[model samples]
Target chain A: MTRGSVVAAGTGLVLGLLALGPALAPGFTLAYDMVFVPHPVFDRETFGLAGMLPRHVPSDAVVTTLAQVAPADLVQKTILLAILVIACASAAALVPSERLTARLAGGVVYAWNPFVAERLLLGQWALLLGYAALPWVVRAAARGEPRRLVLALVPAAIGGFAAMAVSGLVVLVIGLHRPRPAGRSVGVGRSGVKRLPWSLGALLVMSLPWLVPSVARFSGVPADPAGVAAFAARADTPFGALGSLLLLGGGWNAETVPPGYGAAVTAVPWLCVVLLALVAYACRGRAAGTGGLGVAALAGLVLASLGAVMPGLLRWAIGLWPGFAVLRDGQQYVAPLAVVVAVGAGLVVDRVAGRRPELAALALLVPVALLPGLAWGAGGRLAAVRYPADWSRARAVVTAEPGDVLVLPWEAYRTYAWNGGRRVLDPLPRLLPGRVILNDAVRVGTGGRRDLRMAVEDPRARALDPLVRSGAPLTGALRARGVRYVAVDAPEEFAAWAGRLPGAERVVAGPDLVLYRIPGATRSRETPISQWPIAIAWFTTFAALVWSIRLPVGSLFALSSKEP
Target chain B: MRIAVAMLAGIVLALLTSFGVVRVITTSQQDPVVKPLYNYGTR
Candidate 1:
């Protein structure tokens, strides 16, 4: 069989696995959501509730008991299906031989890995799809095809944006239009950049709506120099550089990373290293133009995937490169790396299938390298650093009863309310009056050595509001505000850590979370899931799916047109 | 080449619309304090 057929079939199976895997798995949101499931944002569905109120704001949104089991958003799941379906049809219908195999190999392996799926799970679909369409983008740029590129735009906007809510940063990257000349339309020459004006102009018009806000906010908002900081401090991957790349097993302790949730030795990482190495090697062989670009594109993905966590080059990196941001708690930035790992893996698969005819069967091993990395989601069970649920013991405890204000050091509640249309109290109220915006690893305005040390070591201290001190005092404040319940998700020794306080007592204890209640507060009725962006989110999903399919199809068309 | 730039710009636009348009539409009349989360079905 020709290598082309092998690429097509192999990609088909891989994408089929990605598209079909979650459908068969037990119903669960991705691990990122699992971490954020308990926030009031997840459970309550009230419109204008979270918006109008402060972080301490209680959720007033309504809830629907039944959830749409199909899929949640426009990122991975939808994109995966869209890719498999589109690539298969395109390859079978028009793209014959090397083109079929090579592009097919590119789509499935690069686009459908577990790491990539995680980004989709976290709502980074726009970035994923935008990046997935990169090959096409570069191809179109090289060919000077306006009609096809215009056709590709509709899907780009629809699918990419549906990937998220606070999707500003990724938008910045996507908006970048590399200028190429109109004069050099069909060939490689210095004056080829003239065509750039039209493309940039069109890009500007499409981008204005988003750019306006970002530009407006850019000056006022604090520059998230976190990535820069990590690099500068030379602490980018201080936890152990190469180890994290392959670490599939544990977290703080010997917490066993659940299977397929970012384990100790996922095959994807090594493959990425090898692919990167090959690209570097290939760079020496090829000059400027497409050859340089293939290298450049791979390099961009490598940097993006490495983000801030690549380690060692932190300080030098921060000084020289302005691309990364240091994230609070730092590690959550893993999302980008996962995408890079997947994309890099895809490049490896595509390169192998396209360049080497003999290794078609060996090409299927990419997924084998990826599944083990999903172990991180299990969090080594070490991630169970929150409350333990137990109802038998009776002290004043705060549980997430309906109408109760949830104040915990986790984000689980927010996901439920945000995704499901629910309300949750803010865990951090810095300048706000609500319960919490997001808890854990949040910044404390006042800081010093002592403060830093205490913040790092004391789980109870870390969980407690500096303003309120501990659960007991926190309960007093809540009572003063007519609040009924107080949620605590600190470590098990929280009571011991706070050195024992008055007023609040534990009523319910679970391995994951705890709830507390004030004695005489009135229980206000919960507003139905009013805050839901019901029509909007669904439309987004529909739009994104439509686009993901359009992409590979358009690419196929463009490829066919290039045929002799 | 111009088309590719336009396409990149389009992807960029789509990325913006995916997030920005939603933000604009949802935030237009709402209080600045509240965050309008668009749960664009899980991708």
Candidate 2:
């Protein structure tokens, strides 16, 4: 079968499998931070584009654009499915073989691995999008076609900065390994030098959206070491880390593991490790690209190991540059390894099929039978729900109040009856129309050393622990900080506590939500440094996106005319 | 021309399938009001 036909089939299969659970039982899967509560994306007081620029510019932009036209739940589901299809099809495209079975095997292994499943369970869709685009980035870089390079950045850009970083690494690896010119010395050669700048330039330009903001926020705060270690890939031990890399199963939170998962599943990744070793050995001198991919896979595993084998190294590195905190969740590095393993699996399947075609059908069952729980929505964690109507009523009240609002219970995750009993990021931010000050404290250390206070990163979210606990007078100190309305979605005692505070009047009291208005409070304005970066980043992103799109379209037209 | 066309076509197909999947999944169940009884801070 043709490469395109194979890719199409693979994409269809992935979408079918991914959509099966969501289709059977859908609302909005309230897993992790993927709160599907619908709210205006461009709301200046809430998710204004400017506010989201530095961290999640691309993802927020896409969601904001989609939210403008479609329901938030649909927008999320569509993006999720798109990530799966893109991941599968791109992996299939990377396989050197023309055989449909090999491509299909590669696509399945790449798109539906433990990494994707765990990330899905964790609701890190943006990271998954980046993971999905890695193979395409490698394919584009290897071809060294200008048009392919430009087009490749589109997906990488959509995946956001993390995806671009991964893609950039792949490009760098490929560029370094570019076969030295026929007669040139053993060094990187002239052609390699020329390609390096171009590839790096594309990555830089495409990543400007997040790059600008990341630079601005680089020295703003220090990351917590314990927080970083909590998210580290702690697979039992160093050997377990390697096994987890093979299984793509080193998520920091054990809750992210699908229900009913057992030790037997370890055999699937073990089988993959053996097959990959065989493929690497067989393709050593014959196929340079496969060898390079194998090397990249090994590098990914080592990186994923993080401090597991060499604890002091990662801690030392983190001390030098806190920004490396992003890499703290070493499990994410396993994404590229997954691509290599999938492709390797495909190569092994192709070899076996070449000698005995019928046996290739059995190879397909390996990944399927192993990750049975992932196929059924991470053991039903992907179930969906609707937000409560009271949220809307509270939003309306806050929208009219004209001051920054504070959500009570002062926590990040909540198990709302509105979301079918699943734990989700507090829906208050989405439910409120005005600027919100949520208590996003980073709980670090343990027992005596444990520090649970509002994150220093955003000073706007005032540490309300004292005020809430003491039921202090709301007029003098709290209102001076610009907190106009305090909305508590907790039990009656909490609402009653807030109500008794001096100058706090109960507004919109309901069974689920209670709002207390501080009449004299004012809205706090964001500082210029915080606001300017977003504006500049947005401007750069818009300009880059326009240029990237126009150049490719113009090139396509020119190529079409030349072909005829 | 073929590469660009194929890439665009694939993206369009992915988007369409996404829309279809979302529609089917969302429509399958009644949208219930989410009101959590407990505050489970970030875990």
Whose DockQ is greatest here?
A: 2
The sequence of per-residue lDDT tens digits that candidate 1 reaches over residues A122-196 is 333343444444334333433344333334433343332221111222222322323244322232321225434
Query: Which 10-residue window of candidate 2 chain A scores lowest in summed lDDT?
Result: A555-564
Q: All models, DockQ values?
A: 0.02, 0.09
Give the docking tier of candidate 2.
Answer: incorrect
Compose the digit string of candidate 2's lDDT tens values, residues A1-564: 344544544564554355336523555677665655675555542223222224455666677677889887788777777777777777766555555566666777777666777777767777777787677666556545444565666766776766676666677766555553452222232355566677777777777767766676556655555545556675531346666665677776555664434355455465555467346534531232422444556666777777456656777777777776666667777776777777677777667767765556455545544555565465346776665666677778777766777777656666665555556666676557656766655332222443333243444553555665575556666687777887777654464556455668778677677777887877665553455656676676567656656544322111000000
Residue A216, model 1: lDDT of 28
Off by over 4 Å in 2: A1-20, A23-26, A43-53, A145-147, A180-190, A236-239, A265-292, A442-456, A462-475, A492-502, A530-536, A550-564, B1-43
State the C-alpha lDDT per candidate.
Answer: 0.33, 0.59
Q: Report the number of backbone clashes for model 1.
A: 119
